[model samples]
Target: MLRDKAVTGMQLTLIIAALLILSSIGYAMGRRRAVAAGRGGALRLHSRPSYHGAYVALWCALPSLLLLVLWSIAEPRLAEWLLIARLPDSIRALDPDRLGLLVLDVKNLAVGNIVSREIDPALQAAAEGYNRFLTLSTAAMVVVAISIGVVGAARAIRGVSPAFRARNQVEKVARNIMLAASIIAVLTTVGIVLSLLFEALRFFDQVPFFDFLFGTRWSPQTALRADQVGASGEFGAVPLFAGTLLITVIAMCVATPVGLFSAIYMSEYAGPRFRATAKPMLEILAGVPTVVYGFFAALTVAPFVRGVGESIGLSVASESALAAGGVMGIMIIPFISSLSDDVMNAVPQSLRDGAYALGATKSETIRQVIFPAALPGIVGGMLLAVSRAIGETMIVVMAAGLAANLTANPLEAVTTVTVQIVTLLVGDQEFDSAKTLAAFALGLVLFTATLALNVVALYVVRKYREKYD
Candidate 1:
């Protein structure tokens, strides 16, 4: 089959491009109408004319865009059915798995992909016909959309009766759009929670919740054949919890003092010039990719930690929990510093002045007044940072070992829930296996933990916001 000059996605893109061009043309026409009215100085323009332009633009764009979204979603399903319906009875008679493979080959061949078999003319024609149908549909959509846009724009301009209330309509539309956009936050959270919940439910089906929760072993290996030798399928999460806890504690130890002090200095002690220079410099930390931090943890920080431990007459594993957590803490410092700084700065200047009037030093004013005023925001930011550290995967993956040794010792190599999840899902495995399902369980736990942290942080911030506002 000779492929079309334009693919389906590209065709849709061109139609969108045409719609934008038509919208621009409509805008220009509306502007011209406004100029003509102004020149005549007889019939007053009902609206500031740009509103008429935007009205036309919305007409030109919105319906077509909505149709495109709907069409794109439905096209694949309809096309698959169309192809499957045309398959020969012999091919259709194949088992489900084999039928899938046969369909794959037919699709590949229709796309001019090299196949061992000779050319199939029937399939090739079907593909070409499908392409033609799509192109005609696209062209028709664009033309109809533009025609409607032009007609609608002309009518709106002509019927801009006195008290047409163009501005009110425009404001009403914008308000509705803003409200819809705000719902995206809730939608995203809901989608993520639902996905994790479903997967965790699947995991729970394979491994009993009590076994996953209360059992002490952490082994995830299980044989495909039940008769196979030596395949222990233990599913305890205690070590992962312990490892995560130990690292999180070490990370807080490293991050809190450094981040809080830096924030304090920047907010309270630094000169205007110093604050300007330092704030961006500190935020640069947040922008640095976590992957770079992973390598730094594994290569640079791990060795230094081991050297320090050896000097102190202690044994430190090359891939110790401390190495990963310490680096992860450094990676998250900017989150604490930037957020705390904003909250501290938000504290009313009157409070600072009042404290100073009481003959307190700058340090005393900040420590007693500003810090307390900002404490809720500060705690919120800390909780946010802790959630970040807990969900962190890469630094731990590279620096922390895979052994699920349930130990509190930071110097010992330990694995986390995330690391085990990665290990379970790394290679190709049966999705139904306990190994693969275990990742979902781990993910569900992580999601639940982070969600809890966010709830607490929001509550704290909201309470403080109510007090101050």
Candidate 2:
């Protein structure tokens, strides 16, 4: 085995170095050819020189990498099967779990420092046999892969015929990679959806879906044993949705105007020095941790809200929903301001100039022209803010009462879906119970709601977005 390792070590390293150098040289040569053709002014060429470089790079790198990955997976499995077949009939007859441990020991003995006392003779022999196979197969694979890459690259270079299909071939590879990248995103979203779906199914098996959706009660306790005395678990979730909506409305009220005005001033009113210094400062609002916002809600904002409510002869809970929602609005202000500023800046300066030429004021041009052009981005930013508000957990948990109450009054304490999900999932509970599963259901609802909002925002932005050069 040591002999095999020594024989292959330098060969594999040299092969890898050669592949990199060869691909780089080939791409440079392809570019020179492309530039010569372009300068000759045939004016009927396929693509830019960079496209040719990228084209060769894809062919050179992708196939060999794929082969290496597949071999890495298959070679181990094949080696294990061959070694297992050599094990004595007695060891092979062991239960699967015990046999698995035995196989694990064999693998460790082959590669790791295993003292004789720790290894059985049968396992040590199996390890030796496996190591022999691995070293041999790995060297063969390295040689085969490098040879194929070099040969294919040589063929591509030789075929750099004036009418070479580099452009079409390169575009096709780019399209495939882009398609794969997009599918990865879709697969990620689908995986998230499936996880939520399964958890929701578990919850529904224990608690009726209708009651969870429509019933106003929100407690989630269940008996640890059949003999315990208590009311049956309260599993309704309508109150959570109500609290989420109320807090979101309050946050939107506070954030929309402040964020919009800040954006307008920054984009159209502030001088360059003020804009440069203040823009990043405003964005610092986003940098503040949610935990800091939680304390801000609990310590500062709650007391102030209570005091204001008291002055109006209104009774406010020590942890008012208003405080949490209000601070959340402050947290999201940057979202609206940053996006709206970009959209406003993108609007043609000529439109604003035309308005000024029509004797319109700066305010008039902004209100009539820039704001209209920026409205879609502003709305997209607002939808994102709304999603953030609904998902916020720490601020509401620290400042708002946990009691799940269905009410719209801003001064009243209310619980949100995220807060309830946290409460249910925090303390130790039986994993199989409805109480634990309910968190998953709540999570599914929250995910779906936000996903829907994002889709709608994307649709509106795509359809209504006005482009300017």
- For residues 1-469, could you state the per-residue lDDT of candidate 2 as single tens digits? 2443455566656656766776787688767767776676655456777666656655566677677778767877899898899999999999999888788778767777443346678877888999888878987888778777767666665556456678889878789889999999999989988988998999899899999988899888788777776548888889999999999999999999999999999999999899899889989999999999999999999999999889999999988889989999999999988888888888888988889999999999999888888888899889988998999999999988798988988888999999998998887777788988999999998888888889989999889876644
List TM-score per model, in order. Answer: 0.89, 0.80
lDDT of each: 0.80, 0.84
Residue pairs with backbone overlap in model 2: none
Off by over 4 Å in 1: 1-6, 34-46, 80-105, 115-125, 227-230, 463-469
Q: Mind sharing the TM-score for model 1?
A: 0.89
Model 1, backbone clash pairs (residues 3+ apart or across chains), number: 0
**Clash totals, every prediction:** 0, 0
